[model samples]
Target: MVILGIETSCDETSAAVIADGRVTANLIYTQQMHATYGGVIPELSSRAHLLKIAPLVRTSLSKAGIELKDVHVVAATAGPGLIGSLIVGYTFAQGLALSLGKPFIPVNHIEGHIYSGFLMNPAPEFPALILVVSGGHTLLLNVRSHTSYQILGTTADDAAGEAFDKVAKLMNLGYPGGPAIQKSAEKAVRKNISFPIADVKGDYNFSYSGLKTSVLRYIQKNFPDGVIAPEEQSEIAYGFQESAVGALIAKTELALRQGSYRSISVAGGVAANGRLRDRLADLSAKYQVPLVVPAFEFCTDNGAMIAARAKALIESGIPDYGIQEPFPSFKSVFADAPLVKRS
Candidate 1:
């Protein structure tokens, strides 16, 4: 099957073509202008998607050595993201699908992330344990199959990526804080020191808001003048990163110890984190399970994962009746829609 997938979930406008479950071409254009304001501006993000999505799709098709008429299906992210951004891609893909008289699949954005690891070489084993961490979400899942999963835990407050961004802003580091903080943290003098990730009442759910606040208070007490040297920045950055990544690993270990998963996977943008990858690798090794993480290109929002998921849904017997409106429904996953725990 030939499928064209479009993604405009946040600041990126992406398109990809998949032929028989293999990625032929995937293109992404991120809105770098958001850095000027220290974060994403929704209106501007949507506008940028409108400008780049079409051209990106055209380029993706060209790169794949195919034309629109050759595509058998069209897929696009349907939700759990900025409504404006989701609408842009959803409408575009639907329109194209209608014009070509092809089937349209509305893919869940998080579901796209969940299965991203399946696209990796030596694909993750079935009934895997996946950590889906992104800018807007943090979730631990028991993925039993391509079409089934149980949401084990979710974020009680700010997401891990959100904490990174907020802390970076506190340090005047930069926007898109995950990379910024990671870069600064790498130069830390005291590698062992770090802020603490507060223990939540739930066995597996996460809480990062307290960690963010603790970082803020520490900065205020240590650097009262609101100025920090490069070295000091590194110390704080490393400590914070340690705590954030440690918290994720801690919960994952708890779940792995209790479950019978054969593979441990990390998906979403934060899965690109060096510390998280290393820690998860060690944990997976300890548990004697293969560690599965998607290639860096698929770490963040993209189109190929959506197409890959559409293929999975089709193979799993989910029919694409037609294109529908987008909804920010984080609860409804792939075929066997399930509700995740928040508290």
Candidate 2:
């Protein structure tokens, strides 16, 4: 089967071709313009997708050594993302499918992340615990089977990635804080400086908003003169990263103990963080459970994950081809969840 996947959930315009369950070509165009704005401007993101989607698709198909007419299915992310950005890719996929007389599958963006573990070698064991830490979502899921998932917990406030961005901005680091913070923390000396982790009652749910605020207040008190040295910034970044990842590790351990999962998988953009990866590795070794994480390429918003998910839906015999438009609402997108079985 030849599936063409399109993704523009946030700031990336991506296209990929999957041939017979293998990702043949994946092309992504990231919006560097957002760096100047310190955050994604929805309008700018949508416009950039509109310009990049077509060329990206063409390039992907070419790279995959296939023509558009050869594609059997067209899939696009139908959201839990910016509505404008979602529409650009969704509509483009719809048009392409219509023109080629192919099946159009509207994929939930979050589901793509959930299933991304399947894209790499060493597949996560069934009944795995999945932690999706991304810019827009931080969720823990109990995945009992390939198509059965229970949402274990979710963020009540800002996601971990969002907290990273906000903290980086406060430090004048850069937009897309994960990489910036990780790089800065490499030179950090204050490994013992601590920040409070969110303490949610009676569930595995996450809360990073308070943690973000605490960092802000900490910086204010510590850097009262408003002139932060490079080393000072690095130290602060290290402290923040440690706190953020510590919370995730704590909750994951809780979930692991509760579920007795055979394996644990991490996905979403923040999964690419070096500090988080190292921590998760330690946990995996300590607990003697396998860990599954995508390669750096699949960790972020991308078309390959979408393509892998689309292939899963087709093989599962549960794809909803009736989806005609982008459904960007987060809650409603659950109805279109890819790795969860429908009643």
Candidate 3:
């Protein structure tokens, strides 16, 4: 089977071609302009997608050595993202599928993240505990199977990646904070310093708003002159990174202790953090279980994951909906459609 996938969920415009179960080609274009604003501008993001999506799709197909006529399935992210951005890809896929008389499958953006780990070797064990930490969402899930998921916890306030961006901005660092903070944190010589980690009374839910505010306050107190030396930035970045990763580890450990999950998997852009990977590796060792994380290429928003998931759905007997519309948010993932469409 040949499946073409489109992803315009946020700042990236991506397309991929999956032949059989393998990703033959994946092309992505990210908007670097967002860095100037320290965050994404929805309108601009959508506009950029409109410009790049078509060429990206063509490139993906070409890279895969296939023609549009050979594609049997067309899939696109339909929700839990900027509406304008979502519409661009979703509608494009819909039109293409309709033109080719191919099946059109609308995929949930978060669900795409969930399947990202499947792109790895030594696939994750069933009944896995998944941590999906991204720019807009932070969720812990109990995945019983490829098609079954139960959200164990979610963010009550800001997401982990969002906190990283906001904190980086606070430090006058550029946008797309995760990479900036991680780079600075690596240069830190100071060790054993601590930052606040949210406790979040009951359950495994996460809350990063407090942690973000704590970082802000700490900066105001320690760097009152508004001029932080490079070393000072490193220390603060390391401290905050430690706290954030610690909180995530704490909740994941708690979930593992309470459940019979056989392995742990993480996806989304934040999963690309080297520190988080190291900590999770430690946790996996402690529990004597596998830790499934996708390759760095799949960590961020991309179309290959979507195409991979479409293949899974098809194998699982999921049928495509001929035409569909995109939804803006994926807040009701559990209550959404069975296999296609978000709402």
Candidate 4:
């Protein structure tokens, strides 16, 4: 099957083509406009998607050496994202499906990330421990299969990426803090100033709000003038990243101990972090299980992941095509969606 996938859930305008379970082409256009504003402005994001989605789809299909008519399935991220952005991609994909009389699959954005491991040469096995952390979400799941999951833990407050961005803003590091912090931390000569890892007390649950505040308080207490030295900035960035990733690792370690998982996979944008990747690799090594992390391209929001997930849904005896409206609420989107048979 040739599937065309569209993702406009956040700041990215992506389109991808997959033929018979293998990725043929993937294209992602990240909005640089958001950097000036220090974060994504949802309105701006949707408008940008409207302009880029069609061209991206055409380019992706062209790169895949296929025409629109060759596509058998039309897939798009349907929800758990910016409502307007979701509508742009969802409606556009539906339009394409209608024109071709092809099946249209509305993919859950997070589910797309969880199953992104399938994009690798050897996909993750069932009963894998999956960690998905991004700007809007942080979740640890014991994936029994593509259709069933036992939610191991979730953040009580700020999501991992959100915390990174917020803390970066506080330090004038940059917007979308992950890369900025990494760059700054790289310059540090010493990484001693440590931030506290939160104890959520709910077994494997996570909490980063406390850690975020600690950074602010540290700045207030030490740099009372609100001006940090160059050396101090790097050290602070290094310390914050260490603690942020440390909290995630701590929770993941707890979850790992509870299951007989054959593999461990980390996804979403934060999966792109070098520190977290190294730490998780160590944890996987300790457990003697393979660690699966999406390639940087797939780590961020992308249509390839969505298409792969839609294909899985179709293979699982699911009537994969449908008209699903964009869900704006995070709580309900996550709850009512994914069709997760929680164990």
Error of 4 at 167 (Å): 0.9
- 13-42, model 2: which lDDT tens digit per residue? 999989988889989899999999999999
Better of 2 and 4 by lDDT: 4
Question: Model 4 — TM-score against the truth?
Answer: 0.97
Q: After TM-score superposition, what is the CA distance of residue 310 in candidate 2 from its true location, in Å?
A: 0.8
Mind giving the per-residue lDDT tens digits that candidate 3 earns over 181-290?
A: 99999999965557889999779999999999998888899888888888888889999999999989999999988898888999999999999999999999998889
lDDT of all predictions: 0.88, 0.88, 0.89, 0.89
Question: Taking the tens digit of each residue's C-alpha lDDT, what string does model 1 give over 1-343?
Answer: 9999899989989999999778999898989999989889999999999999989999999999988899999999988788999999999999999999998898888888977887888888878999999999999988888766788888999999999889999999998999999999999976765787777755899999999999999999989999999999999999999999989998999998888998999998899999999999899889899999899989999999999988888887774523346876565433234322222
TM-score of each: 0.95, 0.96, 0.96, 0.97
Q: Name the lDDT value of residue 230 in candidate 3.
A: 82
Q: Which candidate model has the greater TM-score, 1 or 4?
A: 4
Could you tell me which residue pairs clash in candidate 1? none
User: Candidate 1 at 21: error in angstroms?
Assistant: 1.8
